[model samples]
Target: MSSAKYHQIKDHILTQIRSGQWQEFQRVPSENQLAQQFAVSRMTARRALSELTDAGILTRTQGLGSFVASFKSQSSLLEIRNIADEVRERNHSYSCAPVTLESIDAVAPIAIALGVEPGEQVYHSVLVHFENDAPLQVEERFVNPELAPNYLQQDFHTLTPHEYLSQVAPLTEARHTVEAITPNQQMCTWLNLYNEEPCLQVIRRTWSQRGIVSFARLVSPGSKYRLGGHLTFTKRS
Candidate 1:
């Protein structure tokens, strides 16, 4: 079958979801059904579904079927995760808008956090993340250029800062401080939160073999996101 056949199938499915013809948790047609309806091979239909599932438009259950994804988004408090991955795994589309990326002179606070001289230049970035076209989080970061020199040149729309840094400087130690606060207006605008809405913020600092790699402030609006973690205890031998 032509590549256009699979793309046509994907576009149909997306249109159905977007138009509310297929609601969240509603089961999408099986590959066999789609193949028959589209007059294409099952392989083509399967490709469409698999691509949609990988893109987080649909969630599939083994032995069951694929369903339109729901709105809830979640992440782990105890682990450092690529927010893009976190969004997709929850059956939600992930997108990012890069608001700022530049080399800026570090102020006293940024300098202290990065363990650099107060006037040293640091790579800074601000990004707003989206889940299913709705704003989810705002990530503001400062990178130590010595650790990741190309931080400023990265295309954040293609890959998140977390993903890029993990590649260049594998994490050795990470510190997280999570708190609830009322975000400033600019942050509220970034996350699409109302002025009075509360936010969950995590102040994260990561280290590599040499020294600190980055300092970041990750903030999510209270109503639209969640953070959790799980651990299994093992008896020591």
Candidate 2:
């Protein structure tokens, strides 16, 4: 089948879901139904459904059928709101201590994350976040200059990188990973953590309309911070 036909089928289904024609966990049309409706082969219809399933917008079962995935299932750590906002929401004062802010040559790993060539000049910033004068998180970030040209000139003391980037570029997607490790000497000093204290490290990559926007590593002392959020789940009938 032509790629356009399959994509059209996919877009139709996505429109239904987005338009609220399909609710969470509601079964979508079977492949046969879609094929008949779109005048495409069952294989083509299946390809569209398969792609949506892989994208986490739908779920498929062998005996049943494809259904709209639960909203919680599509949730990602990258979707978490800005840290400064989170702190203020808890009625605490938030401040950012600038540690490093400059343009640097991207290394291989940074290049891979930003989808840029190695040695390309990128804007880098490091800030230790504080809540009421006690350090809480170390935010190390690199920005794609192509996406946010004035990244280096931002007054982070008054506005966070997260806030700045959101204004400059519209976010399209985000990726996140979490790990646990002991704080290094630099991290220990910044976060007021002991060397043996484990830290929750969250690495995030964000994309804007242009392309990859920024890559960030956030470290919080495990004893002082924990990641928590409430997710609504549909009860099965």
Candidate 3:
């Protein structure tokens, strides 16, 4: 199968899903169907679907055919978590690449979030997290220098900021604000998302013994990741 033809198959599936033409858990065209439609061999069609499946865009069962995966990955809004641990728990391979790491003068909204004055210097870092080699999350964070000194020195690829922060200043409290967002081009590129795909954003502020430690914006393609938790209520009568 030429790359173009296979890419066409993959692109068709992706387009349907992103355009809401196909709903979650809906079964997609079978290998034979795709083979006939694209005039390609069954092997080629199967490979196309396999690629999507590996990318967390589809789920294939033994007897049943492939269906769009359900909110492929998840995170808890109630607790601060190490993304690496979350991915490992799902039995998926996890990796990360730090895009930006440097010191910057705090600006308005971020300064307020980190409780630092506007001219004060703070550590700023941006990274992308991957699951099974597919980009899953874009993490942009600002750290209070007073709280986590040497913030820009650590290797984020090996030790995520979440993990390093935990070791330096165990989380004592946290706040999370989540919303749906339209990602900018750069963020879309980082998450390997189409421009029209919806994204979930979590603006988080974490505190430790020292005070507000970090403020982070965590964004992921809505199709590939989700955020929620199980909660139980007691009778209050």
lDDT measured at residue 184 in model 2 versus the true structure, 0 to 100 = 74
lDDT of 3 by residue, 206-226 (tens): 888778788888999999887
TM-score of each: 0.65, 0.65, 0.65
- Candidate 3 overall lDDT versus native: 0.81
If candidate 3 were superposed on the true structure by all CA atoms, what would the RMSD be? Answer: 14.9
How many residue pairs clash in all the candidates, one count each?
0, 0, 0
| The 10-residue segment with the lowest total lDDT in model 1 | 69-78
TM-score of decoy 1: 0.65
Q: After superposing candidate 2 on the true structure, give the runs of residues whose Cα lies further than 4 Å from its correct spot.
A: 1-78, 232-237
> What is the per-residue lDDT of model 2 for residues 1-237, given as tens digits with 9 covering 90 to 100?
457888888778766765678897999999999989888899999988975664445677879999886543122644567889988999999999999999999864466567787689999999999999899999999899999999989898989998999999977777665667677798898988656799998777787777888888889998878887677779999
Off by over 4 Å in 3: 1-77, 232-237
Measured with C-alpha atoms, the lDDT of residue 30 in candidate 3 is 96
